[model samples]
Target: MTERSYNSLLSTGRIAGLELSNRVFLPAMDMNLCVEGEISDGEIAHYTARAAGGTAMVITGTGAVAWPVGATSRHQPAFSDDRFIPGIRRLADSVHAAGGRLCMQLCHHGKTASVDTADGRPQLVPSLLEGGADMSALRDNPMDELMRLATATHGKKATYKVADEDDLAWVVDQFAAAARRVKAAGVDAIEIHAAHGYLLSSFLSRTYNKRDDRWGGSIENRARLTCEVVRAVKATVGREYPVIVRVNGHEYGAADGLTAAETAEAAAMIQAAGADAIHVSANAHNPFADFTDGPLPNTVAAYREHTKTIKRAVTIPVVAVGRMLPEVADEMIAAGECDFVSMGRQLLADPDLVNKIRAGERRSVRPCINCYVCVEQNFFDGNPKCAVNPALCNEKVAVLTPIARAQHVVVIGGGPGGMEAARVAATRGAKVTLIEKGGRLGGTMWFSQLTTPANAMLVDWLTHEIERLDVDVLTNTVADVELVASLRPDVVIVATGARRGRPAIPGAEMPHVLTGDGLRAVITGDADADLGSIGGLGRVAVGVGRAIGLLNDADRIRRLSKVWMPVGRRVVVIGGGLVGLELAEYLAERGRLVTVLEEGKHLGLPMAMPRRWTAVRKAAEHGVTLVREATPVSISKVAVRYRVGGDEFEVRGDSVVIASEVCADTSFADQLAARGLNVKVVGDAANVGYIEGAMHSAHEVAREL
Candidate 1:
């Protein structure tokens, strides 16, 4: 808790001649904040906010060394020409003015170049990679189809010719030129992107580099290209300037991927080539693998082992990244596993994470839930966005100034949206009162957290902020028109949330049938199990589950929730939406034979392609049966009957779950608006959406108030 205790992470350090105020660096993340090769005002504002948030160093994401030919994404920043220097210089000056150092990442997408954006030029690669599976390949499972679609649309495509000696020399020169441009821009340091299956990384790994020439086969030969680039960059930027190279510890998907041993050898070679530091990352070449930016749940801090291996191999400083929490990062530094710690999504979730940690207000720091919204947005050709932090990447809109006059505000429902509305309004000098019908502040989040425990962090943060900002929180208070009118509020925000609708199927009212929320409540002991005629065994399971819930350990409860849920040995879920599939997976993981029936053509239709792929894969891995185009007509004691493709089919399960749907219950909004009050609706109350939409709507309404 003391500054001295955080010496390893918060201590001042140097990279070559560049001095970093602290070891916390904002890892380079592609925000798609630029147009062509020029950094826009939005991009400058984005970096400026992070710098002002107390980042010691900020690495600008993926600036292309060669436009059109080597570009990865259409909107990635470009450093291919000297003409772009002025715009980057402005960014550098802004960050420096905020007392933070800036670094430019020079990249050549190489084999990863998008064919549509390559101006019909052949891509340069270490070797012409042989094609694997067909782009349109399909399998019996829905996950394969989703993965194929995600890969075809989201993954970059290119036609490549193996790089000859002349071509390699030209690329080296391009790297040198890009370094010079960055140096001229007044940037503090440069990072050579030799990782994440980029041009340089493609040469460093045997998976792509099969050439027999000076740059392929053995690890030494495969690493030659990276060494050359580092030398060229150092030479052009002058020996005193700092040069860092990013390398992957594991390619994740490649059959003979670059392992940690090979990666460490590559790092040693790069260090020997005069590089100042090694920025370690893992998982590329596989869309399904967690990329740290939006990591999979079980893979938290996934790349720490890689960083440790590389750090032990080389004398140069190593940067560790991979969904690292502040305390975890500090321990890693103190343990000498890595010299510097970088966080991408965490910084996006809370720009002031480093500042909060420094001030010993660690509880106030917002945690990234690893929902992958940030990475998903970028892959879909949108700017980076956070689910919990709606104002992220929109710093201008997030800026809050005090209102002219303080006014009374009423926030209905203590969900994320309502709580955020109260927090923002109260911060801007408003008398805020938040009313929750339940004893808890988090509304639906309390149920949702059972499926994903990470959400508890957001719930805790919002609750903490509401209390800290002095918002009058009234729990167990059923809000009504009469109660709201009695408060005499200037503005009323309805974030009362939505309700799940059970399907009108045969035998729906059977004691064994339950809504998704009802099942979760029974498992967590929020609802009485004895109310349902679920027999003695079910009652005992519910009792045990309630006991675990009383422990108040979200992670532990989430792990054993399925055991507490009083479902029969066989589980039948009547929907294939996000919640339905996740529930099916949870049940299947706990040894239940689960079948998911959905009328929709695909599962998780609203989710991003990559995330959907992961979800469907998870379902398959858990042996959860997914049946598309299936409409449930009846649920009996023995089985569930469904119509699929004009045929009736039945699957037996002990209990039927109506995970069918939810709709925005705007009854309160309609009622409050009828009273002639200045009313606003947010979160599920407005759109029946997720965290991102909820927070964005709340921020929008609160600012206006």
Candidate 2:
């Protein structure tokens, strides 16, 4: 086999006093695996997997340097005292044993600290902003339960006690002691969390810091606290120990915050303060700032320019991190943009990405869809998880163990759930055959690919793995009781996916109205043989769709959707769930005036908050009208009549699309069970949760087999 070319990123590198195996760094991301401020075994396993996967270095997620007063989460690891040293030591040793160097990120949440965690204690800020928790960087998060509770404490504003001169000194000392404790625990480096509008970042922020003391005012004065913390850390850990400073390349949320130019100047000052390396990250309070949404092309390498700008201003190695792809990171390094690349969600999606790239199997590496499930789930008190990779944080629970007796498995359906079931069973030494009634393996996922480009990438990955495993894949083949009995399979998995339900409305059967799946089938030439259901205008839509000349190919559909959407000049999408909201964005972007009618109080149900917020925001930006709590009563050829609070309103549109709930089909599994054969149901066939649910359910059922 020929060696894979990733020379720029795979080259050995040095940061401060430590020599790294590669230029890739796993940037700090909170896993919420700690128990009562102590590192749990789950957290250790989480880090160890990444280390063993061959990442050059790992930065442990943000740990509190000042507990209670500056805690970001109740479960966040702490290094404020000597008591945390033992747990820190075990974590360090595990990473070291796995052939990876580990660094501890020391942080003080400051003004952004959770009010619930602060309890009756005063939340510390650089200056006492009037809003306190209401004005906190974390206040924008819609998924944070703690933030919701804190926001609910109305009447009186969330209290804040501005850090005085004594408090600043005390914080500096706390950081210095944390650095000393980490050094004692054999940590390779200590990264001061000075980004993300945290305590130190609030002081650095021109938008937040209004202090006129030595620690605030000018750029030099505002950055003084961060510089002092860096100096204090170096003094305790010694000049030779590597200390990384994570600074924002651009604070998008702050109106007067540091731009690239200001950030470069700040970076130069940080290096001058004896810091070893600069880890460049961006976004202050915006939840969507860190993880860019997938589907669009512009979000690729979103933060490389920031790193390139800062690299020229400082002598220390700059680590650039954004929604960077492996090839993009390599090219950025080759172009001398930055010395290292840091991956957060990418690593979570597949820790073995580096290993796969090294083995010339880069195509097999799972991609991070940038769905923001990790950040969304974490803030909701759940451990981080990847939509594509089900075994992300729940590594121990999702492990695939070999069965005592290898049996023949027949999986009905070629969707994500079925594909995953086949892959797992085959890997566990079972003879597997996957049958799909559709011509393709991806069920509704092909339609999903049209909405989000990353979902198309996921289909590519899933199909490739199924093929690589040598599983028998039979497309256009329906599985019934007779077929399974002929094969005499010991186990049968039915993942026959979900179907979009039709609502009972006056014009529901009108030819002008189309189901979301019907629209997809028309686009891909997978429509039913009967053209009558589409109506007279529907035939025109199909003809125009066929003229685009796309088959089952997702890439072509995606390219076509960008320029040519099948909808009319005016479109109204009913049911503003994930599919409806996404389709509205898709239609509106193609010059169609779109309106989304949802019965639910919110758009994008079942989707995580970050993704929902992003999709809804993008739809609004594209001029897509959203009407919540609107029940569709009937549809006319030229308009849609929906009711809200006993008031009927008509939305004029040329075309109406039904993007409603999907119902699971368990008839296949039920029939198989009746025949006295072992049967399992997964994915939409069992429950309709889209990708995350499908993959997770598949993994769970397949593991048992």
Candidate 3:
């Protein structure tokens, strides 16, 4: 925990002649905050927040070498002409004044350039990609999302112009010119993007580049385009200036995809071509399902091992790009695996991550949760915002300045939303008291950790913040009109969460049938198991375990579930919403024969696109039977009868769980409001946005009180 322990992480790093404050670099992430080629003030504020928060170097999202010609997204930053120099200069000045360096990423989104397609231009490609990415996963997206993605290109057709000898020369010159423009704008460094299925990366990919010319075949030949770009960039900026080339460490989901050995060879070739550093990244040959395996990976320390492979191949500094925790990055650097580490999504979740780690306040740093909420916005060309941190692109609105008068605040319920409100209110010099009827602070979110482990970090963080801010917390105490009136609270917030109703089916009250709440109670030991539902003497054993408080700890219960659980071996989940699908997947993974009956066509509708796609695919892989447009008829002791297409079907299951159809419950808030008390509803109690909605509503309400 001492400063000396993080010597390598906090140590000064040099890329060519440029000196960085530390080894932590903000990876290039497309925020879609710009307009055409112009950078917005909000965009500058976003980078300025991170730079000021203690990032050694902040890499700007991909700046198109030719705006609207080879641009992927309509809102991506552009440095193609001198007209955009002022915006780049402004960002550079702001970042430099904030005590951090600035690096601009030069990109040309070859075959996937949406702007080019919209503008009726033939996009330049190394060789026209034979087939497109697997887009079957997108079928799970809602109708609105599908339409938005379709019209994002403005209803234009795409055409390709294969790059010939003359075309290659033009591409190289464009990159050199862009590099010159960036240097004129006083940018500290330039990162040549040759990863993530971009223009140069396609040439680097052996499978994508099928030309039999000098620009194809061998790995060295296939890497020629990227190497030339690196050389041209180095020449344009001169030898003292930094030139970092980002290449894929490995390409996933392709038989002939670029491998680690190929990438190492490419890195060496790039270094020989006058590149000062290599930023190692991975790419998914298939963008839909394998995306989590690539550029914006969901795994912790995803590209850590790949960097070790590339580092051994090049004398130039190696930059590792993926999700790297502070401790893991430090250990990676200390072991001479990589020189710099990029924490992209983590920094977006909490800009002060570096400062927090530097101050030994790592516990206070907010977690990203890998929810992919931010990534969902890019499909619609909207600026990205964090699920937990509501003030990502709107930093000014996040000011926590104290109010003129101190007031008393009371928050009903101790869920994520309630606890967040309490934390924020207390921070703004208000007296906050949080009351919960349950014995534990976290509501259902604690049990949600059974399927989503990342959620635990969020609950832990909010609890820490609540305690740190000195908000009075009362567990096992109910919030009522009498109790709240006695406290004399100036403002009250109700975050009691959603309401659930069991399906109107025959034999709904059977002892073997459990509601979502019933399942939670049984798993957390908040409610004892029904003897009628349990087997002979095993029922007695479960009751004794609950009575003795052995099931109090969630982790212990999760561990015990693998060996023993009160639920039956076969499970039938009603309603294929987020809860039902996640529960189905979780149960299936635990060796249960699970079947989900959904009245609607979609599954995981409430989740983000990437996570939803993953959940559906994984559920299928785990052998979960999904029946759409199905209405439950009745629940027998052993089988569940349902109707799919006017035909009756019966599926045998030992236990049935109803986890569908949620509605907003504002009865408590309405009662408090009718009494003339300032009342606000947040989280699922107001709407069902899950964690993102909870955090957003909490921030909005807490800032006012």
Candidate 4:
């Protein structure tokens, strides 16, 4: 890579007269640190951390410009009252002190706002349609009266009144007044939140805006309200102060909503009406709109593509957003796709992303793997967290301060958990030794990298971190009881991971049968070649005769390509978890007739909701047969028998893959405990769960140590 200076991104780009020291922008994210609509110290610290991290501008969470019905949540911050000016001023001052600019994203929540009114009253929208409100809350309510109750609960019965033409004008004036107050508070910029299915977004979208008046008909008419708000903010703050608008490049709904082309025209209008820049996003109301759950790694490309259109239509700079990796962001800027990159979850994942990049310490920079857990927490868990970087939300409490009593530590695994523990311990000034039986550090991640490219990033990150921390890495050196005792570390982290539990099913012990891990090892050419030859099996049929019986057709082909197969084309996958589903899809893609026999009622039930839904949808689209509420009873050379609904059925298949149980091996921990060794267990060896749990547990154990 040719070395080039980032002087432009590092220096402030002028929007009217407001100056930002850099182009790094922290997009809006609800910190959920507000108490009764008042910004708490936690919220202040959260924004302050971003500013301190050297962000050029910090955009506060959606601050309601309109009162009552326009607010999304009771706890969401508001700019409607001057009482917030003091708090806002404090935030601005903190940002300014950190050499950063501060901006508030003014918003209105339309129909999707929480219906819990201040005085126990109802909510309101442009239309009083039932089931039109955000359906997330309805999942917990009873089905019988859910829609009716939601409609009634969301009806404006108290402070919120249906907005008429005059009401719309009044709301516009309110935004202008709020802008004036924010400018007075020393905020460098003001952003209009016209995206994410908020009130402004609803008007821009054809689905929410049903009014036949000038604010509802065509795309231009629907966008009139947002344009007016932008113009009002510009008028109030004067042309010297920067004012940006965030808009959805595309709304994913059946309604003939604004397309990227239409959104570009609207953005141009907003710019022409005095907006300084346009920030592009997608998926208006979806809680996981950050593109974490999407299949693509370059989520920002969607926005970047649309920003190109908007850039052509407008004179102002376009800000692109999505799941933008730092490298991708730099490319976008280099290519002139967007003048600025608006990062939300990525910044939350690693506030020091830009700082690390500037220092040429890319390895030290944590990567956002696009897990929607951050958004999921905000929408459901009520607290956002980054899976990779545990110090995200609780930064004030989780800084990388040196341990008071650093000691020698031995991590007995080379997987994600062990690697994380070793890295953290080494960083905290501990003498760390990481022992792995394998030659490489990543363990199962080696297999994961083949399945998903983004997972490769984790391996790279872990490898880089391990090298940076200078931990002693002993590859192909398994730590035995004698060896561990001889090392005599102050602490022992047992992250030996889990072993594939071979169930006592028929033919499970057959030489033809292999475990999923065994298959992956063989497929990746990392398996001991001697093992396959020692069994006197010329070429093992690496197909359905595998453990967990979840090797899909594609995986079978990949495996068989290494060891030729004379078996039939039929296959049966026994598990419906993420692994099983993925295998099934792989098999079906290769023209193999695949049947997934899941013991659970729902396929991929163990996966997170967002991931499970996407997996299930993909499985369905791939024509993979699903036999839920079924368990495999037996597997034979020509056929597999399973029971579903108390009925036994034999499905003929060329091979059977077992995708079921995995057991954690903690015998090492027991032995160490018996020997009076200080030991902490982590990852699958402690609890069989997702990568998030494993990484989190390892980090926690290291922190405690």
Best by lDDT: 3
Q: Model 2 over residues 581-700: C-alpha lDDT tens digits?
A: 888987887788999999876677666766766677788889999998899998888999999998999999777888885688888788899999999999988988888888889888
List ranges where model 1 is wrong by over 4 Å: 1-5, 115-118, 133-157, 288-298, 527-552, 559-564
Candidate 3 lDDT by residue in tens digits, 384-477: 8789999988898678879679799999988889998898889999999999988777787887877887888889899988999999999888
TM-score of each: 0.94, 0.94, 0.97, 0.87
Task: Report the lDDT of model 2 for residue 534.
Answer: 53
TM-score of 1: 0.94
Error of 3 at 69 (Å): 0.7
Task: Give candidate 4's error at residue 202 in angstroms.
Answer: 1.4
Among these predictions, the greatest TM-score belongs to 3
**What residue pairs are clashing in model 3?**
none
TM-score, candidate number 2: 0.94
Q: In model 2, where do residues sit more than 4 Å from their true spots?
A: 1-3, 115-117, 130-157, 286-298, 527-532, 535-549
The CA lDDT at 605 in model 4 is: 54
Q: lDDT for model 1, on a 0 to 1 scale?
A: 0.80
Error at 647, model 4, angstroms: 2.9
In every candidate, how many clashes are there?
0, 0, 0, 20
